[model samples]
Target: MIGWRLSGALVASGVLLALWWLWGANARLSDDLAAERAARLAAERSAVLARRVAEDEARAQLQGERLNVELKRAAIGRSDPVPDYLLDHLRGLGVVQ
Candidate 1:
């Protein structure tokens, strides 16, 4: 009878240990999944920021080109008489008013 009682206790202990191990594994997996989701969100935000930066750079480059052309035209006009088209444009801007 004592031997049977000992074996039953051992079996119960083994089952409890197995349940504890499985619970820990499930908790660890849950944490890992949450971490992966956070990482994915961060990567998406970085991609959006990079795309915005690229668009801003392109716009700046286009504006720089336009300004360069205007400066060159102004420099040329300084050495010659102003054309009728420029006078009309100045009037449109209220610069000649």
Candidate 2:
């Protein structure tokens, strides 16, 4: 009877040990899955930010080009002959006397 009790106790201990090992492996796998999900989320966020930055840069470039074209047009359309009143003011200031 004592031998039977000892054997039963050993079997229970072995089962408990196996359960503990399985629980530890499951916890490790859960941690790895969480880390992988976090990494994927970060990569997705980075891609969105990169796309936004590229769009902003393109818009800025287009605006800059439009402004440059407007400046060129204004420069080309400028009249060279000064107004008479402005010429008289310059003569009064002795700048064109």
Candidate 3:
């Protein structure tokens, strides 16, 4: 009778050990899957941010060029003859008084 009980106990312990090993393997697989998903998401987010930054830089460059062109046009329009600054002209206008 004691020999039969010892055999039963050994069988139960073997089954428990197998279950523990399976559980550990499953947990490791789940962790690996989660880590892979996180990496994929991070890569996608980085790609989108890089593209947006490139687009923003291009837009800023275009705006700068437009502003430069406008400034050049304004300067050209203001390129007229200079006013006379003689003392006689100031005296006639009563500015020297």
C-alpha local distance difference test of each model: 0.81, 0.80, 0.76
Instruction: Go through the candidates in order and give the clash count of each.
Output: 0, 0, 0
Candidate 1 local distance difference test against the native: 0.81
In model 2, where is the ten-residue run with the lowest total lDDT? 66-75
User: Could you give candidate 1's per-residue lDDT for residues 29-71 as a string of tens digits?
Assistant: 9999999999999999999999999999899778766654664
Q: Per-residue error at 35 for model 2, in Å? A: 1.1
Model 2, runs deviating above 4 Å: 78-97
Clashing pairs for predicted structure model 3, backbone only: none
Ranking by lDDT: 1, 2, 3
Model 2 over residues 1-97: C-alpha lDDT tens digits? 9999999999999999999999999999999999999999999999999999999989977876664465456447753545568657755755443
Q: Which has the greatest TM-score?
A: 2
Better of 1 and 2 by lDDT: 1
- lDDT per residue (tens digit) for residues 5-24 in model 3: 99999999999999999999
Per-candidate TM equals 0.61, 0.74, 0.71
Task: Name every residue pair that clashes in candidate 1.
Answer: none
Ten-residue segment with the worst summed lDDT in candidate 1? 66-75
